[model samples]
Target: MSAHDQLLVVIDPVARRIDGESVRIAKDVLCAGAAAKICLPDGPEEFSRALTRRGGRRPVVVGDDHALLRAVAALYRGRELGDEPLSLVPVGSVASVELARSLGVPTGAVAAARTVLDGVARPLDLLADDSDGVVLGDLCIPAEAAAAASVLHPASVWDTCRSLVRTLVRPAPPAPAPRAHRLRVEADGVLLSDLDDPVEDVRVRAGDGAAEVTVTHPRHTGAEPLRTLAKVVTVSGPGFRYRADTLDVGPVRHRTWTLRPKGWALTLPPAGPPE
Candidate 1:
């Protein structure tokens, strides 16, 4: 089979444990449509090995956002990300596959698998940090927002009742007001904010060919978020944590990210007609 017709489907362990049926369905669809080599990796080492030995076959991940991130990071570390377009069959909780949904990958098993076989490879932008870290989505300083957003739903009625009872028994304390960080923010080479002005939060989004930055101040509740766009962004402050994609990273004092225009590619279902 030609390279375009060959696929290396890497089924993540978490996906297998979470949804075996969807995994089976996705595998069936992909294998029926193309020459697919299934790789059920036992761990990270094996997972990286499968991608490394994929030869010319396109890589398809049957897992959640974390799995997709892993696949991309692997290719990126090997310096093959720009050339190897990835396809994903999102299989996990709704929250876990959010990144896949955001990227226009189909969430359903059959649809996503079929997409792997029939979709077009679209180039997408990404943020590369000074430490060689990659951000497939936006990054936020102070990971609290991301952490609070990822709370999983109660699995059972009893679990729900327990949560309700706990809430009533010891009503949660009020959330602390937003605090300001003394971070120095710079876009491209222009300074947007500095340590002198305490800022509430800073967010950087990887966009078309530039990073969209927003800085807000805690003191001005009604004030608009300070926004700008640039090819590069730098944030330096007293050690602080940040959320990149779905992962929490750093208590570092400083960091920089450069926007790489159309730096990576992913196979996605074709866009439908505009309404």
Candidate 2:
């Protein structure tokens, strides 16, 4: 079979969760255009297992942002993602997939699936933390990103992993009540914002081997967010949490993230506009 002839189609549970129509449409589009092997794993372990065994088949994910991110994270952990392009057909609530939309995946199930069958392969940057986690979209501080899996710190390992992946794949939780956090922000070791200045908000993304960082200052008057590019971004101060794509990141006093340039690849439509 040609490189794209046979496919490993991994469907995230969330897609078939509310109604099966979305997933069914995507599946029909893909199967009609290409020969594929579909795997509908029931849990994270099965999901991870399905991915590991994807020999030479290009993986086309049918789900939302979290499903895509989880697959990417799993691939990243295996260390075989070096130029292996991934295709996505986003399926879930609109808000749950803002990241996928921003990244240029077609929102319509048929559009996304057909694109996977015909789109050109492209590379994408990733923001990786000390923890074995990956972020595909912008991360914001002074935000409510409860560790997508953190709140699921349960009594058993099996329960923890299962519950964590489920919660992680769900829609973003509502923002918590407003509360100010005094945090120190540094880009490549240079202080950008200090504790004296209560952090209003901050955003970060990977680009050109460095992270493009933006920090906002609280104001009664209009003020633009501070922006810069650096290899490393460290946040420390009173405990804080950040929203990385669709999941929440921390409540710890310190966290550091680095840019991994073109560490992963994506499949997008030919002649598509930049994301």
| Top of the candidates by TM-score | 1
- Could you tell me which residue pairs clash in candidate 1? none
> Alpha carbon lDDT of residue 32, candidate 1?
94
* lDDT tens digits by residue: candidate 1, 1-275: 78999999999999999899999999899889999999999988898789888999999989999998888888888888898788899999999988989988889899888888988999999998888888999799952332233467647988889978998999677665666788899999899889897788899999877889999877555777899999999999888788989988888999999998998999988872112
TM-score of each: 0.86, 0.81
Kindly give the stretch of ten consecutive residues in candidate 2 with the minimal lDDT sum.
145-154
Report the Cα lDDT for residue 223, model 2.
72
| Candidate 2 global CA lDDT score | 0.82
Per-residue error (Å), model 1, residue 71? 1.1
Please state the error at residue 171 of candidate 2 in Å. 36
For model 1, what is the C-alpha lDDT against the true structure? 0.87
On lDDT, the leading prediction is 1
For residues 58-110, could you state the per-residue lDDT of candidate 2 as single tens digits? 88888888888889888888887664799898888898778888888788888
Among residues 3 or more apart in sequence or in different chains, the pairs in candidate 2 whose N, CA or C atoms overlap within 3 Å are 63-91, 145-248
